[model samples]
Target: MRILEGAGTYVATTSNHWEEHLEVPDLSCGTYSLPAGGTDPQSPHTEDEIYLVTHGRATLWTPSGSAPMGPGDVAFVPAGEEHRFIDIVEDFAVVVVFGPAEYSRAESDTD
Candidate 1:
Protein backbone atom coordinates (compact mmCIF):
# COMPACT_ATOMS: atom_id res chain seq x y z
CA MET A 1 0.00 0.00 0.00
CA ARG A 2 1.05 3.61 -0.62
CA ILE A 3 0.24 6.69 1.34
CA LEU A 4 0.29 10.30 0.19
CA GLU A 5 0.10 13.32 2.45
CA GLY A 6 0.37 17.08 2.19
CA ALA A 7 -2.50 17.76 -0.16
CA GLY A 8 -2.37 21.45 0.58
CA THR A 9 1.29 21.64 -0.32
CA TYR A 10 0.68 19.58 -3.41
CA VAL A 11 -2.10 21.86 -4.47
CA ALA A 12 0.00 24.91 -3.77
CA THR A 13 2.71 23.76 -6.15
CA THR A 14 0.49 22.54 -8.91
CA SER A 15 0.64 24.76 -11.98
CA ASN A 16 -2.18 23.16 -13.89
CA HIS A 17 -5.64 21.80 -13.32
CA TRP A 18 -4.24 18.28 -13.06
CA GLU A 19 -1.13 16.99 -11.30
CA GLU A 20 -0.55 13.29 -11.57
CA HIS A 21 0.53 11.45 -8.41
CA LEU A 22 0.12 7.77 -9.03
CA GLU A 23 0.49 5.78 -12.24
CA VAL A 24 0.09 2.04 -12.47
CA PRO A 25 -0.25 -0.27 -15.43
CA ASP A 26 -4.06 -0.07 -15.42
CA LEU A 27 -4.87 3.21 -13.77
CA SER A 28 -3.72 6.70 -12.83
CA CYS A 29 -4.71 9.15 -10.14
CA GLY A 30 -4.12 12.85 -9.65
CA THR A 31 -5.11 15.97 -7.88
CA TYR A 32 -6.95 18.61 -9.86
CA SER A 33 -7.28 22.17 -8.70
CA LEU A 34 -8.32 25.41 -10.32
CA PRO A 35 -8.64 28.84 -8.81
CA ALA A 36 -11.50 31.16 -9.47
CA GLY A 37 -11.49 32.40 -13.09
CA GLY A 38 -9.04 29.67 -14.05
CA THR A 39 -9.67 27.53 -17.11
CA ASP A 40 -8.76 23.98 -18.08
CA PRO A 41 -6.55 24.11 -21.17
CA GLN A 42 -6.65 20.45 -22.00
CA SER A 43 -8.31 18.48 -24.73
CA PRO A 44 -10.51 15.43 -24.27
CA HIS A 45 -8.62 12.32 -23.26
CA THR A 46 -8.63 8.85 -24.78
CA GLU A 47 -9.34 7.18 -21.43
CA ASP A 48 -12.41 7.35 -19.24
CA GLU A 49 -12.09 9.52 -16.14
CA ILE A 50 -13.78 10.12 -12.80
CA TYR A 51 -13.67 13.33 -10.81
CA LEU A 52 -14.40 13.52 -7.07
CA VAL A 53 -14.82 17.09 -6.02
CA THR A 54 -13.32 18.00 -2.65
CA HIS A 55 -13.62 21.74 -2.53
CA GLY A 56 -15.15 24.88 -4.05
CA ARG A 57 -17.80 25.17 -6.75
CA ALA A 58 -18.12 25.38 -10.54
CA THR A 59 -20.13 24.28 -13.51
CA LEU A 60 -18.99 21.21 -15.42
CA TRP A 61 -19.59 21.38 -19.14
CA THR A 62 -19.51 18.56 -21.63
CA PRO A 63 -20.67 18.03 -25.19
CA SER A 64 -24.06 16.99 -23.89
CA GLY A 65 -24.60 19.78 -21.35
CA SER A 66 -23.46 21.56 -18.19
CA ALA A 67 -24.19 21.05 -14.51
CA PRO A 68 -23.36 22.63 -11.21
CA MET A 69 -20.66 20.95 -9.17
CA GLY A 70 -19.51 21.31 -5.60
CA PRO A 71 -17.91 19.44 -2.74
CA GLY A 72 -18.74 15.73 -2.59
CA ASP A 73 -19.86 15.66 -6.20
CA VAL A 74 -18.57 12.89 -8.36
CA ALA A 75 -18.46 13.26 -12.13
CA PHE A 76 -17.73 10.84 -14.90
CA VAL A 77 -16.49 11.61 -18.38
CA PRO A 78 -16.24 9.11 -21.14
CA ALA A 79 -13.26 8.87 -23.43
CA GLY A 80 -13.05 11.41 -26.28
CA GLU A 81 -15.68 13.67 -24.78
CA GLU A 82 -15.22 17.42 -24.58
CA HIS A 83 -15.52 18.81 -21.07
CA ARG A 84 -14.31 21.53 -18.72
CA PHE A 85 -15.13 23.57 -15.65
CA ILE A 86 -16.37 27.13 -16.06
CA ASP A 87 -17.34 29.99 -13.76
CA ILE A 88 -15.28 28.80 -10.85
CA VAL A 89 -16.65 30.54 -7.76
CA GLU A 90 -13.79 29.47 -5.53
CA ASP A 91 -10.59 27.48 -5.63
CA PHE A 92 -11.88 24.15 -6.80
CA ALA A 93 -10.09 20.92 -6.01
CA VAL A 94 -10.79 17.30 -6.90
CA VAL A 95 -9.30 13.86 -7.03
CA VAL A 96 -9.29 12.47 -10.55
CA VAL A 97 -8.99 8.89 -11.66
CA PHE A 98 -8.25 7.57 -15.15
CA GLY A 99 -8.66 4.00 -16.24
CA PRO A 100 -6.64 1.91 -18.71
CA ALA A 101 -3.38 3.24 -17.40
CA GLU A 102 -1.43 6.32 -18.29
CA TYR A 103 -3.37 8.54 -20.65
CA SER A 104 -0.78 10.25 -22.77
CA ARG A 105 -1.67 13.84 -23.44
CA ALA A 106 0.85 14.05 -26.24
CA GLU A 107 -0.71 11.09 -27.99
CA SER A 108 -4.20 12.47 -27.47
CA ASP A 109 -3.11 15.82 -28.92
CA THR A 110 -1.80 14.06 -32.02
CA ASP A 111 -5.01 12.14 -32.61
Candidate 2:
Protein backbone atom coordinates (compact mmCIF):
# COMPACT_ATOMS: atom_id res chain seq x y z
CA MET A 1 0.00 0.00 0.00
CA ARG A 2 1.20 3.52 -0.88
CA ILE A 3 0.07 7.06 -1.35
CA LEU A 4 1.40 9.70 -3.80
CA GLU A 5 0.86 13.41 -3.76
CA GLY A 6 0.82 14.50 -7.39
CA ALA A 7 1.79 18.03 -6.43
CA GLY A 8 5.00 16.83 -4.84
CA THR A 9 6.58 14.47 -7.36
CA TYR A 10 5.11 16.28 -10.31
CA VAL A 11 6.62 19.48 -11.65
CA ALA A 12 7.00 21.48 -14.86
CA THR A 13 10.39 22.47 -16.14
CA THR A 14 12.44 23.33 -19.17
CA SER A 15 15.12 21.11 -20.78
CA ASN A 16 13.06 18.14 -19.66
CA HIS A 17 10.44 17.35 -22.25
CA TRP A 18 8.39 15.53 -19.63
CA GLU A 19 8.60 14.01 -16.17
CA GLU A 20 7.68 10.48 -15.11
CA HIS A 21 6.85 9.45 -11.54
CA LEU A 22 6.17 5.83 -10.78
CA GLU A 23 3.38 6.01 -8.27
CA VAL A 24 3.24 2.24 -8.04
CA PRO A 25 3.61 -0.92 -10.08
CA ASP A 26 1.33 -1.26 -13.08
CA LEU A 27 0.50 2.35 -12.43
CA SER A 28 3.20 4.81 -13.48
CA CYS A 29 1.08 7.86 -12.90
CA GLY A 30 2.43 11.39 -13.32
CA THR A 31 1.83 14.81 -14.72
CA TYR A 32 3.41 16.21 -17.89
CA SER A 33 3.84 19.76 -19.09
CA LEU A 34 4.78 19.63 -22.73
CA PRO A 35 6.18 22.80 -24.20
CA ALA A 36 4.20 24.25 -27.03
CA GLY A 37 4.97 22.52 -30.33
CA GLY A 38 6.87 19.77 -28.54
CA THR A 39 6.38 16.26 -29.82
CA ASP A 40 7.13 12.77 -28.59
CA PRO A 41 7.64 10.25 -31.35
CA GLN A 42 5.99 6.87 -31.49
CA SER A 43 6.99 4.61 -28.64
CA PRO A 44 6.30 1.03 -27.61
CA HIS A 45 4.54 -0.08 -24.47
CA THR A 46 4.24 -3.51 -22.90
CA GLU A 47 0.69 -2.85 -21.74
CA ASP A 48 -2.32 -0.70 -22.36
CA GLU A 49 -2.08 2.99 -21.39
CA ILE A 50 -4.68 5.48 -20.25
CA TYR A 51 -3.96 9.20 -20.55
CA LEU A 52 -6.15 11.66 -18.72
CA VAL A 53 -5.74 15.36 -19.28
CA THR A 54 -5.43 17.51 -16.18
CA HIS A 55 -4.91 20.81 -17.93
CA GLY A 56 -4.27 22.59 -21.24
CA ARG A 57 -4.64 20.77 -24.57
CA ALA A 58 -2.85 18.23 -26.75
CA THR A 59 -3.07 16.33 -29.99
CA LEU A 60 -2.48 12.61 -29.89
CA TRP A 61 -0.88 11.10 -32.95
CA THR A 62 -1.46 7.40 -33.31
CA PRO A 63 -0.97 5.17 -36.29
CA SER A 64 -4.65 5.62 -36.95
CA GLY A 65 -4.45 9.43 -36.92
CA SER A 66 -4.46 12.49 -34.76
CA ALA A 67 -7.10 13.51 -32.28
CA PRO A 68 -7.40 16.61 -30.14
CA MET A 69 -7.58 16.26 -26.37
CA GLY A 70 -7.97 18.83 -23.67
CA PRO A 71 -8.76 19.21 -19.99
CA GLY A 72 -11.22 16.53 -18.84
CA ASP A 73 -10.28 14.41 -21.87
CA VAL A 74 -9.17 10.83 -21.54
CA ALA A 75 -7.56 8.64 -24.19
CA PHE A 76 -6.98 4.92 -24.14
CA VAL A 77 -4.29 3.39 -26.30
CA PRO A 78 -4.69 -0.29 -26.96
CA ALA A 79 -1.67 -2.49 -26.38
CA GLY A 80 0.88 -2.62 -29.22
CA GLU A 81 -0.45 0.46 -30.90
CA GLU A 82 2.21 2.92 -32.04
CA HIS A 83 1.32 6.28 -30.61
CA ARG A 84 2.82 9.60 -29.57
CA PHE A 85 1.79 13.05 -28.42
CA ILE A 86 2.20 16.33 -30.26
CA ASP A 87 1.01 19.93 -30.46
CA ILE A 88 0.94 20.27 -26.72
CA VAL A 89 0.35 23.52 -24.92
CA GLU A 90 2.88 24.57 -22.30
CA ASP A 91 0.21 24.37 -19.62
CA PHE A 92 -0.56 20.70 -20.29
CA ALA A 93 -0.52 18.10 -17.56
CA VAL A 94 -1.79 14.55 -17.80
CA VAL A 95 -2.21 11.60 -15.48
CA VAL A 96 -1.41 8.18 -16.91
CA VAL A 97 -2.40 4.71 -15.75
CA PHE A 98 -0.87 1.47 -16.98
CA GLY A 99 -2.88 -1.57 -15.98
CA PRO A 100 -2.47 -5.32 -15.38
CA ALA A 101 -0.18 -4.55 -12.39
CA GLU A 102 2.25 -7.26 -13.42
CA TYR A 103 3.43 -5.25 -16.40
CA SER A 104 4.24 -2.22 -14.28
CA ARG A 105 7.88 -1.23 -14.07
CA ALA A 106 9.67 -2.65 -11.06
CA GLU A 107 10.62 -0.08 -8.47
CA SER A 108 14.12 0.35 -7.14
CA ASP A 109 14.56 0.60 -3.41
CA THR A 110 16.69 3.42 -2.01
CA ASP A 111 17.76 2.88 1.53
Highest-scoring model, TM-score: 1
Q: What lDDT, from 0 to 1, does candidate 2 have?
A: 0.65
lDDT (0 to 1) per candidate: 0.77, 0.65
TM-score of candidate 1 to 2 decimals: 0.83
- Cα deviation at 71, candidate 2, in Å, is 0.3
List TM-score per model, in order: 0.83, 0.71
Write candidate 2's Cα lDDT for 11-100 as tens digits.
555523455566455456655566556666547676678888876777888878999988778899977678877877655667776664
Report the poorest 10 consecutive residues by lDDT, candidate 1. 6-15
